[model samples]
Target: MTYEDIRVEHRGGVSTIVLSRPPVNAVTPRLLMEVLSALDDLEERGETRCVVLAGSGTKAFCAGADLKADNTLAAGDSFRDLGRAVVDRLEAFPKPVISAMRGWCVGGGFAIGLACDVRLASTTTRIRTGDAYLGVIPSWGMSLTRLTHFVGRNRALDLLILGEDLDAEAALQMGLVTRVIPEEDYDAELARIAERVAGGAPITFKAIKETIRAQYMYTPAAAQALETHWSDIGGASADMREGIAAFREKRQPVFRGC
Candidate 1:
């Protein structure tokens, strides 16, 4: 599909979604919509088992939302609706989603990274939750919840209140990211991780993802319901059959997202 603000590429079972608005890669409503659309397409295709969300340049994964370009701000419901839609799409994505951070991931940019299941960053990457500095607070639902869950209440509060950027290593130490590798090895490392995830049992991975997300965001009853649903799907899936067959044959499994 044609995209104005992002690029989507699929290689094997790994799909990389790259934010393309150069330099800072600040998101606008249009860009956010495009990203949501791309993710929707990927889910519908059912072939992509892992996704890496990154930016086009070495300078930024994404700087933040472009307040100047966000025309929906004064449009009330549209603005909130768009933000919620993007967050919801990311949260519900069936596969493992990774955010590859290179430079500045700030404000709304940080929100996107937080929405992903895993975040991997270059050692020089910086993260900022800059909402307070802009005279607003973060309104993205699950992103803030996930951030607080990962970094704990104190660090999350410090990030939001102070609006200071945390370097990649510090972010990893604070539990904001899964790994921080040197910039020179960032791309290779991310590709390696993505491929590893893609090669895993697709149905089992989806089940695990659902369970973790439920625990992260839902009440016990709700989490249980989600767990049951995902368990049923995973138990009956063709991917499960493939996994078993491959195991018995001592070969790699070929999953068709079934």
Candidate 2:
């Protein structure tokens, strides 16, 4: 897909979407719209088993919403509605999505990473929950719900209200990021992580993603039902046949994502 402010590179079964705006990759309406558009394309294609989201520059993953952009703050809730919608999409995406972070992942940028299934960051990465020190709370779901899921209510409260900036190691410890790698090894490490997800049985991965998401969104009974539903769907896939056959034959399975 083509976009002015974003770059998408698809290889093997993994698609990497880079936030392509300048020095800080600051959030803009156009940038968010392009991200949604790219997501639509990837979902429809179904060939993408895993998605890795990262920013283009060495400076920041995303600097936050562009207050300096024309009519950004003037649009108000309409603009925030778009941000919420894109984040909802990310939260429910069927395939695994990983956030690869470096530099400043602040404000809404931090929320974007929070929505991903996995987050891996360079050692220099700094993430803030609400940036409350600036009197800015996350308009996205992170403050109300997502942050608590990652770090529990007390820790989430501390970060959201106190506006603490979490470094890479702290983020990893808090479960905000799955791994923290040195800047030198970040690229190679993230590639391996994406490849690991892409190499899994596609049906199994989808089922697992859905089950976890359902657990978050539904009651215990409802979540169990959802899990059972996905399990059934995955159990009947052609990939399952290949997996079983490969087990019997003592070889690695090659999944076609069927």
> In terms of lDDT, which candidate is strongest?
2
Superpose all Cα atoms of candidate 1 onto the true structure and report the RMSD in Å to 1 decimal: 2.1
What TM-scores do the predictions have? 0.91, 0.95
Write down the lDDT of every candidate, Cα atoms only. Answer: 0.82, 0.84
Model 2 spans with C-alpha error above 4 angstroms: none
Worst ten in a row by lDDT for model 2 = 129-138
What ranges in model 1 sit over 4 Å off? 70-77, 142-144
Clashes of 1: 0
- Residues 1-258 of candidate 2 have per-residue lDDT tens digits of 569889999988899999988898988888888999999888877678899899997789987888898867776887788789878888888778999889999888888987888888899899876566676656877777777876799988888777777899988888888888999988888889899888788677777767777766776687788778877876889998999999999998888878
Supply candidate 1's per-residue lDDT for 133. Answer: 74
